[model samples]
Target: MIEQEQVLDALRAVYDPEIPINVVDLGLIYGVEITADGDVTVRMTMTAPQCPMSGYLLQQAEQGVRTVAGVRNVKVDLVFDPPWEPSMIKEDALKSAGILTDTPANPVEGDCSTEK
Candidate 1:
């Protein structure tokens, strides 16, 4: 059986084309599942649905995770149901991005909360 930690480590290597940070740190990767046969499934989303590089980025993530020794198959699912907001970013990622502003980058309208 493949360890979940190993799959996470592989995910840490993928990055978004527009961001200087990796997808894991950016909070783009929502979930990861490793099946008994070592197949991996990743659920992820982009900052925006119209992101031109979404295809390329997802492909890279799938390929990168497949490079892990125990992984036999990789599948990446792209979703945008909840939509992505700057608030979803990890604290460390925000700090690294130098985004000290208390305001959310793409505020939706009435949802006001500084805490994520």
Candidate 2:
């Protein structure tokens, strides 16, 4: 049977071309679902809807999930409803990238700063 952890482990190998961190640490992956028959479905979003590497990144993610031994089928879904934010990134990843900082109660207030 396909396991979600294995799928996630596989996905951790995928990295965004523009970022130093892997997709998992970047929080690009929203969810992963594996069926009894070994089919896998992944819900994810890109850092930006207009990102030039979106197609390549999605392809990489799909290929990564397919690397799991028991995954017979793989599906990657791109969603933008909730959107991606700096806060979505894992704390460790952010810290490693030197982007971690205190987040304001109202994120929209712009307390977070990005280093060009």
Candidate 3:
């Protein structure tokens, strides 16, 4: 049987070319479900809906999940609800990247873009 941990571990190997952190640590992965038959589904989102790497990232994430020993099929679902924010990043990953010393309650007000 395939385990969620194995799926997650595989995704950790997939890095966002635009970001230094892997998809897992980037908090891009929303959830992972593995069927008894080894079909794995991953619900995830990018920093923004217009992210140019969307297709490539989805492919990378799916390929990564498929690398797991028992995964028969990998489906990467892209969602936008509740969107993504700087605070979504894993604590350790943020610290390592020198992005933050402590997680914030609200990192951004609206629109993840840096334009001000």
Candidate 4:
């Protein structure tokens, strides 16, 4: 039987072409469902609805999940109900990508820097 964690681990190997972080860390993956017959379904969304890499990313996610042992089939569903925000990004991934902005010492000074 395939486990959800196994499928997630496989998905961690997939990254957005324009982003340094993987889909999991980017919080693009919303949910994972595994059937008794080893079929896997992934619910996910992109950083932007009009993202050019949408199709490519979906294909990558499907292929990535299919690599998991016992995963007979993989399905990826794209959703945008909640939408994606910068805050959804994992702390580690954000830091690594120099995307997490730190609070400025003085709000009026506007001294925010992207570098951690």
Highest TM-score against the true fold, candidate: 4
Off by over 4 Å in 3: 101-116
Q: Which residue pairs collide in model 4, if any?
A: none
lDDT of 1 by residue, 1-116 (tens): 88877877888888887887788888888889999988999999999999999999999899889988888889999989789888887888777778655665785666665446
Global lDDT for candidate 1?
0.85
On the 0 to 100 scale, the lDDT of residue 109 in model 3 is 64
Q: Which ten residues in a row have the lowest lDDT in candidate 3?
A: 103-112
Ranked by lDDT, the better of candidates 3 and 4 is: 4
Worst 10 residues of 1 by lDDT: 107-116
Q: What ranking of all candidate models by lDDT puts the best one first?
A: 4, 3, 2, 1
lDDT of each: 0.85, 0.87, 0.89, 0.90
Itemize residue pairs with steric clashes in candidate 1: none
Candidate 1's C-alpha runs over 4 A off are 101-116
Could you tell me the C-alpha RMSD of candidate 1 in Å?
7.1
TM-score for all models, in order of appearance:
0.80, 0.82, 0.83, 0.84
Please write out the lDDT profile of model 4 over residues 1-116, one tens digit for every residue.
Answer: 88888988999999998999999999999999999999999999999999999999999999999889888888899999799997998998887888765754444444455334
Q: Give the TM-score of candidate 3.
A: 0.83
**Stretches > 4 Å off in candidate 2:** 98-116
Residue 36 shift from truth in candidate 2, angstroms: 0.4
Q: How many residue pairs clash in each candidate?
A: 0, 0, 0, 0
Clashing pairs in 3: none
Error of 2 at 100 (Å): 4.3
